[model samples]
Target: MAKIGFIGMGNMGKAILQGALKEFPKTDFVFCAKTEATKLRVHEKTGIDYADSNAECANRCKYLILAIKPQFYEEVLNAVRYMLTPDHVIISLAPGRTIDQLKLNLGNDKRIVRVMPNTPAMIGEGMTGISCRKEEFTDEELDVLTRIFSSCGKAEYIEERLMDAVVCASGSSPAFVYMFIEALADGAVRCGMPRKQAYIFAAQAVKGAASMVLETGEHPGVLKDQVCSPAGTTIAGVAALEETGFRNAVLKGCEAVYKKCIEI
Candidate 1:
């Protein structure tokens, strides 16, 4: 059986498949795009074969990634469901579409893996949250998914009940991070740094700070304290951020995302 079959060849789907190929070069992969032009373009770029349709992809692969948008899930699932066997595992990437929801479409006995992966996956630095019943997947099946995701970046398995929080925390948070970087770069540009250089400096600094948290295993507040020696420049900036309710704003934004996720 084919290792993975992708239903969409969009950015996330392509990125993830590329990552998996790098790690599991011998594994077979097939994908189906909505248009012949897209299929040809992705084939030329990736050197991966394409299926004639979504159902063909499902029939040929043991694991299927439903990478299309949430709005199209009903249609695609309906089209492909009859082709799926009990041996096939469906991996879903859409937020708010819970395992229960997918089971309602594909039947409760169908094996489903729900994951929330973000835009950073395009760069092999993404964070993904995966959820599936432990007993539903064999060790080999779980390992395959782990390798596919960890080849790109970090992967964590969490309970499905908390999947919506994963949407707010990582799935949709890349846009928030990008906006933060842009604002930081703009502030630096206002302070006389060249625009391009400001972006590099701001982005690298954010990256370094994140690495420090992960590498040092220190609490984020403690890390902030380390940079905030009495009345220091960093402390001054931190004070300004606190004064402007920066943390509150980020919290509110996440709250909004959480609300929208559950609504869908």
Candidate 2:
């Protein structure tokens, strides 16, 4: 639907590119990679074109997504600055870059979109937060992006200011969740369950609980209450978790992640 250029082809970049390509087969695609071998891999995998530099892609693509790490944005943008024009749509998945900073660095002539997405996107179950300072984009822009993210799960349009918290709640929480799952499975093994089976059971239980919250549209507390009968095993487990400051620990973990994102 549109000529899209991705400036990095790492994990997130490849995931998004493949998802978008599947959604819009006719969408012109180009990419820049750090190595020729990496570019060849992308070509073999998706049959997408390659660009000599970010500036080359910026000059040709209607939507240019910067999929590199935030720390490298300045280096990349500075190199590609002259190729950008008022006609291009710039999007970045990097957290530290803001509309004001982008405008200052890339010139006020271009339109801007910013997104923060988590690793879950690799499985088509990602939660993405999107925002744009641009006054308008063509129908093609909305169509391709909506399909690109929808292919990987869900996306929500929110104020840019909330992106830091989005990073806290969804973007970084997956790693915490994985750690929790591993700990639960290890505890199961300690209690005599097979290690592999324990992991399977623990993971499925987490999936079921999360699905209940989503499908039932009920507060997690209500669903949790339904499971925890008075003085029962579930309640006992809940008591132990509460005693360990589970909730406070979770908040503090998220806070620490947010601070790290800011530091980035």
Candidate 3:
């Protein structure tokens, strides 16, 4: 039996699995994809085993990641709930599936951990937010969970009440960041830069700026001020962005994500 099992080999599932593979032995991981071909392909690519069904995965593994969509939670949990044991730790990546709801599905005794991790896990730069009752998980179990997530990126445990905010802030913010990068590239292209070079320039700038925020611990506003001199070109661009409601647009996008998260 593997130590970690993924029931759905979707994008997010594969991301987390790949990240874990870097930290754990391949033999310690197993997954069940939607089809035999996919299972075989993933097994071939990653050298990880595959279970024939969700129940088999649950029966064989101690830690299970239910990587399926939130809508499928009830169906999948119903299929394997009986296979779950007291020692089994079920990790959920979907938003709005609270610990109480999972407990209702898998019985009150089962341990459930809710996680919100972004797609950037694919590149070892993901940000993950985990939520669970401290009393429910022992120090060793929490440490294991933290290590698993931190293998790919940063992980923090927060109150469940803040999970919806995390869903918008990190889980869905990547899309917004990508859009901003695309806009930056488009502006560069309009100024006669080649599309390919424009993308590289735009992406690297965004990456550098993000690194500065993380490494320097400076306020973003202060960073902006540092870049903008008296009546400088950067200040003019910032004024244009403010005039066109760039910040408000990002806020609205985050609001939409938060609404949909609770709706799910």
Candidate 4:
């Protein structure tokens, strides 16, 4: 039997599988999809096995990961409900689906973990937020789960109550970051730089700035201050951004995402 099973083979699912394969090449994986074409495509891409149905996949693996859309959660869970047991650790990727809601679908005692993973998992630099009840998982189990997620990128355990915030801060922030990068590149293009080169510069700058924050363990504000020397070009740009309410815009964007997550 496979050690892990994925009920959906979507982009995020594929990304997680890619990361896991890198760390556990010998571990077997089984995936289930709604169609034969998808199964064949995923097999060709990852060289992993496929199951005929959700229950078959769930039964074949100790770790069951539900990567399907939130709207389909009920149907998928019901399909595999009979196969879920105490030994199975169900990991959910859908945002806004709380552990309580998942337990309602399965049993109240089902072992479940809720995770919020961003799109960067595709490149192995994703940030994921995980939440689970202490009673549902042992330390070793949690560590194993963390390893699976950290294989793609960083994984941190967070309180379930703060999950909506995580969705805003990490899950949906990548889109906002990409927008910022595009805007930066557009500014460079306006200054006569080639579009492709502008994108390269803007993207690398963002990546390096983020790395500095992580590696240096310094506050972002302090780092920003360092870049904004007296009467310098960076300070001038910062002042322009402040005048245009750049920080406020980012805060509002995050608020909007958090609101939508709550609604979901």
Over all chains combined, what TM-score does candidate 1 have?
A: 0.98
43: Cα error in model 1, Å: 1.1
Clashing pairs in 2: none
Error of 3 at 252 (Å): 0.6
Model 3 spans with C-alpha error above 4 angstroms: none
Q: What value does the lDDT take at residue 83 in candidate 1?
A: 92
Model 2 lDDT vs. the true structure?
0.84
Model 1 per-residue lDDT tens digits across residues 159-247: 99999999888887888889999999999999999999999999999999999999999999999899888978999999899999999
- Give the worst 10-residue stretch by lDDT in candidate 3: 69-78
Which has the greatest lDDT? 4
How far does residue 119 in candidate 4 sit from its true spot (Å)? 0.6
Q: What is the lDDT of residue 200 in candidate 1?
A: 99
lDDT of 1: 0.90
- Which residue pairs overlap in candidate 1's backbone? none
Candidate 3: clashing pairs of residues = none
lDDT for position 132 in model 4: 90
Tell me the lDDT of model 1 at 172.
79
Task: For candidate 4, list the clashing residue pairs, or say none.
Answer: none
